[model samples]
Target: MRNNHNDKPQWQPATMTIHGGKQRDEHGALVAPLYQTATFAFSNTAQGSARFAGEEAGYIYSRLGNPTTDELEARIAQLEGYPAGAACATGMGAVSAAMLAFLEQGDHVVVADAIYGCSFALFSHLFAKFGISVDFVDMTNADNVAAAMRSNTKMVFIETPANPHLKIIDIAAVSEIAHRQQARVIVDNTFMTPLLQRPREQGADIVIHSATKYLNGHGDVVAGLICGSAEDIELIKMTTLKDMGATMSPHDAWLILRGLKTLDVRMERHCNNAMRVAAYLQQHQMVRSIYYPGLAEHPAQRLMGTQMHGPGAVIAFELDGDIATARQVLDSLELITIAVSLGDAETLIQHPASMTHSPYTPEARAKAGISDTLVRISVGLEAVEDIIADLEQAFTKAQQLKTIEQTEQTEQQGEPLTYG
Candidate 1:
């Protein structure tokens, strides 16, 4: 460990994650120090001028850069195999800043149709209001994506194993197509995280993350990250992040750094627990469909195996009944919390139609394969048997509710009622 700036060793991923971005002070403490100051004082006016003029390198203000944030950025960049990274205040902030950096008025963007609901709203509502045109396409189909591209197309934005539906897209293929047309490929890697997939190695020009999820591993902090080449990162940071004021706070950055140290271990458990839970749900009589890439029945199983190191923790399944039955299951569950966010240590669940995707009309929701009965579960690091027991109890409760409803209908009609 020579601390050579030019020649770092090619250590394994686990080692890199823990020790990659450490710059120690004179005390030589093992952990990186948090530089909490708002401004950096210069030795002289000439030195300050050089730092400001791009002739030298150093931090002038916390808004621009801080040692704690720099360490977090460096660790993430190394994990994602990128030259540089920019940390932002929130995931939406990262998405907005990155998109605004390269796109201008009258420019067109080809985006994946089944993106995060808020993201879809941002593009369809906010970006459209600014004169930037967007075409939504099924990114899983390469031909459709290529067809959607226009002469003014500046970017192809996608989210693999897309939110809620778990649709898979060929990142390398789309990147190649975009490059041929002189467009950039930006991938939202929030769902998969760096432990599961690295979009940069697969040819994406930029990778973004909602560090509020898996990166923090706790539900306490909200943050965002973007990684790419040094030139591209600096360009976006100077223009969008600086002007828009979406910079991450030093305290949040410190929390993310602490979470990063255990990312590999946490993700392993998440994948393991999720696979077992998905298998159990697939065999349930009340479950209409189960969507988890770890299941061999998944359409994207083969591709996910090829591209990602592990299947993610989130699983979406539809109930055989209606929205009421879905609500019953959520209410009966004793262990898992019903919540919007995911990737925390505790198991969580939510219904997409009435909660996350309520903004979308029925027709729009159907197009994205989101039905009223669809329920999403974010498996946590709980014991497999206990999680299964909770589900079994929930199913029993749902059956009882159906029986009581049938009895009430029979009494009202004054005739025999069929259980089917």
Candidate 2:
């Protein structure tokens, strides 16, 4: 029930975030009020039967449907250009439900190697116990994706500008490969909110988000979203999502709806700040490597431009030393908070080797390209100068204090520090 009044006139994208999917009553409240009921009453028993039998179009219970949650789903679906969407209690809830909807027990799933740690654990341990098989491959190379496909491959799951490492996968290329094999393509579109990238328009069969990150923007709420065709979402709603009972609450839905309003402007500042931070890190003497799609030399630079509007807010880099050095940088930060979640209003930083991706062993992480010295930074809506100053001071302290050696050096021009 989007605010489709003729007077509203279907305002543009920026306006849609504020005014889209709105439902109001005779009171004419400016914002969508919370429909706090756990169940909706029918006029009579026949109406109730019609709702459960799918013969009528009304909510029967909170688990199946709620007005406030429906409005939030409608707005996200419209924004992401998907025919329909579903709300979940957490990001993983959306992810698990989507996979379970299309994939059978014997079906195979091809996933990118550098995915979120918890997702890696899901495929490796949880699904394997249930007879589902998975393959982890580097998706930056389109050929790697194609090679991993099998006749039983039912899905190709990927994350563009992937978690922690910030690697960009070619959505259109992977989607084409999967579709040709008669497989469904699912893209984790969390890092680059719908404002910056549209995976559905790029040929993805489904899109999922850790709405707790960019979609909610603020750190207070936790929610997940799955966006796709009506048929697919209906299947998930009737089966996997519904049976699991991982429905989002009306209050959390309202909070995420509020976050979507400022998402566009917030992302603009985040991208701006991250690009500046990445540039500074690239030239620093104590930094060994930087991973950001915004960097001109990034491996996925060409693909990032064609697939994404911005390089995104998160940046990952490696210090010249080991875990102790990475820990020092986390402790030395004055402005950036030591935290894991990204896309927040405040800058946050974490040591991925011990924090976000710790579920994987050292050997597995290294094979997946996460180094012991890697530091993942979620740049926020802060001044570029202040953020850069904080990083510079941390680098100095981490190198000098941890190793007891001066990090500053008059290295030959055009040469940056290197680590084996």
Over 285-308, each residue of candidate 1 has an lDDT whose tens digit, in order, gives 999998988888886776765678
TM-score of 1: 0.95
> Model 1 scores what on Cα lDDT?
0.88
Q: What is the lDDT of candidate 2?
A: 0.86
Clashes of 2: 0
Task: Give each model's clash number.
Answer: 0, 0
Candidate 1: pairs in clash:
none
Could you give candidate 2's per-residue lDDT for residues 242-325 as a string of tens digits? 899988988999899889899889988999999899999999988899999888898666766467878888999988877878
**Per-candidate local distance difference test:** 0.88, 0.86
